[model samples]
Target chain A: MRKWSWMTILVAVMLLVSACGSNSSGSQHNKQQSNGGNSGSEAEKQDVTLSFIHWRGEDVEVLDGIIAKFEQEYPYIHVETQVFPSDQYQSTAQAKIADGSVGDVFTVFPGAQFQAIARAGLFTDLTGESFVEHFEPNLIAAGQQDGKQFALPYQLVYNIPIYNVALFEQHQVEVPLDWDSFLAALEVFKQAGLTPIAFPGADIGPGQLMNSMVMNNAPDEDIFVKLEAGEAKLTDEWWVKTLAQFKELNDKGYLQKDAVGAKQDSSIALFVQEQAAILGTGSFHLASNKASNPNLKQGLLAPITVSADEAVYEGIHTTTFMLAVNSKSKHTEEAKLFIEFLSRSDIAAEYANGTGQNVTVKDVEYTSEELQIVSEWTTKHTRFQPRFTISNGEVQKAVTNSIQAVLSGVSAEQAAAEAQAIVEQQIGQ
Target chain B: MKKHLRLLPFILPGLVLYAVLFMYPTISALYYSFTNWDGLSPSYQYVGLQNYVKVSEDIIFRKSLGNNVKFMLTVVLIQTVVSLLLALQIYKKSKLNVFLRALYFLPTILSSVSVGFIWTFIYDSNLGALNKLLQIIGLESLAQNWLGNPGIAIFSIAAVQAWAHIGQMAVLFVAGLQSIPAEIKEAAILDGASQTGLFFRITWPLLAPAAAIVVSYTTIQSFKAFDLVFTMTGGGPNYATEILSTYIYSSAFLNYAFGKAATASVYFLLLIAVITFLQFKLLRTDRVSY
Candidate 1:
């Protein structure tokens, strides 16, 4: 009985100590925030910790080098970087923001995902920031919502699919400059018994493909925005044509048999193995592909879906990796400083060369011939990826599903009608 | 009261953990199911069954439910039978039997995501080993796009789920098999009972508890087979492999409709409960006595 009583007493004592420890720890935390190391010794002075979160696991090495440079320049601030896989980043970021533990600086996807975070009132407006002037206006406009620069675009990517220039040269096939020429090029590849385009029909592949497919097909860039507001419908000829483009690819044996099951990795492998002539992805994959197969010469193919005269946009481009300071951040000025440092011409050039990406910051030169080839689009008539303009994921899924449905043997008309019905339901909601 | 008080200190941590982690989320999910929360934002309106009404009308939800039922039935039937048969074949204590059982159980120790990736390579339409092997054997007609075909995608995953868990269920059956009274089996054999007759009359009857356990566990396992489906196919080739858990996740994460996801979760909870209850009743048997 005495032992039991003592054990109970010990348990009570533990609970009391735990409660008291928690209270004092919380108070000490508040005190630390209030002082911010001002009253402490020189070693403790202005030692601010800034959390920077991004989803590019592949860019971690390059980003780490950049962050190290940033820290050396700004010794008073310690930046913690959190990198998540791109697959789960959107949901994870949203959850972090909701739980009030979001990064001091975080990345936002252009258009829909940006609109979502901006709508949540989490973005610290960057319109007045001096770094905002570093980016080209047309490309950086993607990060703006309702005329406010909520985020600043960094990575300037051409959404046009990357094709094998070596394959084209070997087969005496020219780079297709128009719809008719594109069909002729496909015929050349098919006749040679190679897949004209390696199509990854699953996951984000179909959606990414839509950007290039619909570039010249849509009458205007506001078509997706209009669909959201009920001013336009997905059943419109432009949208149907986009779905039909994929159907035509399938029907013509340009893609592999049962291409509907293929994934991005598999298709990329096929391209690297020379089983396919064109990889149906973007410039974002250039660095990885070069690393995978050095002999593989790459070129961009935007697939002009209309006559040269009717084409308004020559290709698709997106300014993504939109960096924004969180509205709830404690070290907003410090976070902004990091973003500003990245905007410096020399630093931006380094990032561009390191990542093999086209940074939106002006005067950043590309050393990679592949990137140099794609960099010409920075001066061309490039349309922003239209699919990103749809702020609703379900609506975006519906539009992308239309293409998938057509690939799976559904008629373009029926797929368009089904997609339009979903649009109507969404607009009604 | 004194006895209970003495136990309080030991139970308190576990009790608090259960309440905080499980009970709190469950209750909160129930509350959110009644609202129009977008998952991330704190602000939301009380919609009062609007989400339920919408999910009922949702075609994808119906399709996913149908897929889940098919997945569950296939996994439960296949896993239960295969594991039980393996248990019967190697239930006796021997060095060879022990090695075989360990080999069978090895896959269970692997993480589902790792297993999903390995199996994904095996199931790939063009580059997969399964198709390659089939073609090499001159059985080209038997080659399939395992994870791609809408008709067989769910079943392909179901087969994986069974294969991944069959060892654990077999181990459980081994214990049950060992527990059967030796005298009863001896008597059945001495009475001129054939091998088949002896198994039906004695061994199977004694294995009721294990079968009940295996069936119940398998039924529940099929419903929560998320990572395998997610990493393998992501419920695609146009939702051919979409099940309840994936559907709910898509509603919350993909669509950002937390209210709809919560409602679906409630439906899923009720579904598992009803199925598990029916399973128990159908497999009910009296506790054996000597």
Candidate 2:
């Protein structure tokens, strides 16, 4: 009797262990099946939550309005938005990507950065989609890599020379159209006891502005393209001339004395306060100026007086902010739908008018005067200069540093040569 | 054997975490440094010392290393002196001492990002308080672009970093000072030793362990300095403030050169290891008995 009872207990213990194992395995398998089933069903379902990440603090109100409209129309599919501080965006986004916690949709800039992310397969490809056709051809080109589209350019930016119209009119300084005329205007402004131009050499974006101004008049885009391709050296005559011009401006005391140290906001403040006569920036600055100082009368000039007689207003369409879908997102379709909706001309128009974004949608009507100026510039200038898009980040740093060097009394020729060397070293050319 | 078996559970969790988090990545990083991996792509081709060779040839990397050394020296020497002085002053029991200690340590408690932003405004050429104060005090000529000039930019950034951490160091020093027996100080006073002589002979000698700890912490912190330089100048004004960590970050994320970044990390780790080893060896003095 005792042996039979002990045998029964042993069997019971074995059965319990086996039951637990099978139960856990069964649940895991069930989970996999349900996940697959849900993904399949998600395609047909309209109700979903899509998260979007951006770093545009200044345009938060306009973005919120756009989100509200989106939510209103697609009630079942709610859109959640998160904005990161601009300075920490890259690091934060990189960390999120590493941890597999990035939002369903995120913003990506064009150039080598976009290429790097795309190469990593972090973003979903949206090529050959009807939504891509709606973007401007130049913007489409900016977002493409090896025949695949990884990002959609939301805005077409034109690096135009913006001047204080009231300051110019008050000082009786005619708007310059070419390099010589621009230099002549600088002298006149300097002689009149006014700072001629304010450039933020301390920040990289402003430094690139100086380079873009010279590149606008290059005999051919080949100079820059060759440099990018490692075929051209920085010691080229065109680069030398470009650097020399930068030095001349600095040597003549035309630029702000503390230009090298000036922050972008500080530089903008000077231009808005009419402390400086000219500032080189995108047409988007028009709206920014109005927002910051409603009283300041600002005028836009196309690519600061380039030497090109035929393409006098040659400008580069920098890859402005763009929205990309995370490849690893469970709700990729929903995210893609959100991107498509955001890219539509009508929706873009609402955002542009509401937020003063210089969006690139061709069919969008301009409601704001600032946007109208950008539209006018785009229509007039068909030929566009390609901004520093495909260069390595080190190359960008080198170029920015070279510009800083020029502002600090280093000869432009020397700075350009050093920049060329740095680029070559970075690309292993 | 039973005792060893019982001890296993206590150390297992820490061992597992360290192996997974630190050891695995470290070993992988060392292995990846030999390849041409960009942190993506399924396969990587072995480059075999190319990254190391490139590090030697890269001028920017060399400049970054030099800058890091300079930052460490400045932060350690200046911060140590300032902190020691402040700690000495705040070692007393008066209410004023507590108030002053709290005030000094306030900056350290704030995030480096906030401190950087505040300092940026304070150093702004046109709108900054520093220039305004200079103008008000008739020292306008001395006020130049504090963070804009390459010659003074790195040191200016270092000053901010030092100011931010001085309080923490001072507090640590104060604790060390207080830990010293009061009877010893009284005995020195009774022996007719001057305050300065007593400080040099008794207090400073006994405080060697604290000083060593402070130096090691400051050195490590200075070596990895990123946020302030990133926020303030972004290693700008002709790479004046570029440090090793920022350079490695730009190489890895910005340039997508993961192999080079890993190599940089390896170098940095080796450097820190050597410094730490030497510090302990040199600073491990005879312990003071109460």
Candidate 3:
């Protein structure tokens, strides 16, 4: 009987321990409240901490500076920033949002993913906010679904071919302006024992590469819109040709043998190390590439024409990243204030200068020479990438997978058809 | 009744925790499996049998299921045989045995993420140590893309999983071997039974219980393999290495198809349950006694 009583006591202690363990958050909240009590009026006035989450862990230093500025501007509001890797961000963010534990302000990818979350009422609609007026109208439209803006672009990125000028000079391969010349240059580089292109054919890389090629032969600006409207399909003649050409690069062994396995970092390393002549990337890599190989001359070029007959390269422009406020946030006002501060022209300029990324703010000038070239491209012949017009990330992912499948021995036609099937299936739904 | 009441408190806490944390989510998943819930949507409609029907028709899901089956069978066979061999080699009491046991178990302590990163470098096509070593050994022709080739990427990943987990199985086997009385083995030796003959006739038969535990564990583990696959190939090279777990994750989070993901998970659980039960039944042997 005494042993039984001891067992009961043991059980009670465990129960108490677990009960206390589960309420640790509650205890912390209470502690915060007690701390607030010490400050009195100042705490009562505006002591609120807002959680800000984004996916770019590599940009933590840049974000830290921006966050510091945000905190200084709004002393009463404390901003806690969390970063997740790009690969895991979507899944992690989705889980957090579903459980109502997401950051007060979170980053969302544009297009179908943004639309899906926004349509589900997961993002606070910033439709008529005054700060929205300062953004480029096109950028604002990118985050809108049926006239309700749920997000705003903070960074503008231009996807083009970033070439190693030294490699080009070493191999005596001219920068190609059209499809034929591109193939010719690739042959020259291959002959010179250099990888023609460092293409990370995994995840979103293949899709971006395909997008770079398709833009060369894009029938018109409305092609993506038509595809979204079900008037055009991935199996269309232009897309099939574009996909074939994309796979041709693989078939010709212009891309490294294991580009399908290598990720962005490894593939980019090839370019930075001068082992590869070209990288299909954006202005984001300019600073890092220059820093890593300071003596290597580098330049960015717009997507080459798909045909020798084409007169000009169709430059591609898209919002790189966007900031959104969680609809279920307890500190909604504070989250919005953080977003507003982050979107300010001066702040955006600072971010642009800090990260060497192009700003999406309506008339902000950047000092980065790489961004200056991107600005010129945007002014000239820029077209919205498929992500901006077609809103389904899964469909885009399917397309990326299909393109990669071609490298794994799947026929170009089959890959294109498969990608089209995904779009069709989504439409059927 | 009063005496039982005293035990109630002891059981109640554990029961409530299990109910809330494990059973509740399981029941919720079962319920969600029947609905067209995107997980983030505030409300969802119960779409009877729709997600299951989609799963049946989905080629990627079928491929993922096949990959998981392949991974399970391969890992179970390889890990079990290798670990049993190691357990036999090091079952004797010796200082060298202790050191080798610890050395073999080192990889099991490392996180799946670290293992994935390490193996990825070893298999890298260009600068990977594996290819470089192959070149150094003048076996360059035999060098292949371990993770890139869709035909063998699943096998490559399975091999890494087996390598990491073989130590645990080896330890389990050693315990089982140690449990068999020395008198039985001495009796067999007295009968002039050779070592291999003794192992086959006695030791193998007695290791059934341990084999059951190991096979069941490995099967469930192989079915639930996600972290290594996620960290390494990301179900890529056209999803050649995608297993059911990674597929379910992608479906739920990436595609925002929670209902489909949940349905697949339920199916996965049922499949694993049936397989594990069959495994225990098949591996069940008459208890060996002196």
* Most lDDT-accurate candidate: 1
Candidate lDDT scores, in order, read: 0.83, 0.76, 0.78
Interface RMSD, all candidates in order, equals 6.9, 10.5, 7.1
Each candidate's DockQ score against the native complex?
0.38, 0.36, 0.35
- State the lDDT of candidate 2 residue by residue for A155-174, as single tens digits: 66666667888888887878
Q: Considering lDDT, where higher is better, how would the candidates rank from best to worst?
A: 1, 3, 2
Which is better, 1 or 2, measured by DockQ?
Answer: 1
All candidates' TM-scores? 0.92, 0.88, 0.90
Q: Which stretches of candidate 1 lie over 4 Å from their true place?
A: A1-45, A99-102, A424-429, B285-290
lDDT of 2 by residue, B169-255 (tens): 999899889888888889999999898999998898788778888989999999998999989988878887889999988888777
For model 2, the TM-score of its B chain against the native B chain is 0.94
Give the CA lDDT, 0 to 100, for residue A6 in model 3.
86
* Candidate number 3, chain A TM-score: 0.82
Q: Supply the TM-score for candidate 1.
A: 0.92
Sorting all predicted structures by TM-score, with the top scorer first, yields: 1, 3, 2
Q: Chain A structural similarity (TM-score) per candidate?
A: 0.89, 0.84, 0.82
* Residue B208 lDDT (model 2): 79
TM-score of predicted chain B versus true chain B for each candidate: 0.96, 0.94, 0.96
In terms of docking quality, model 3 is acceptable
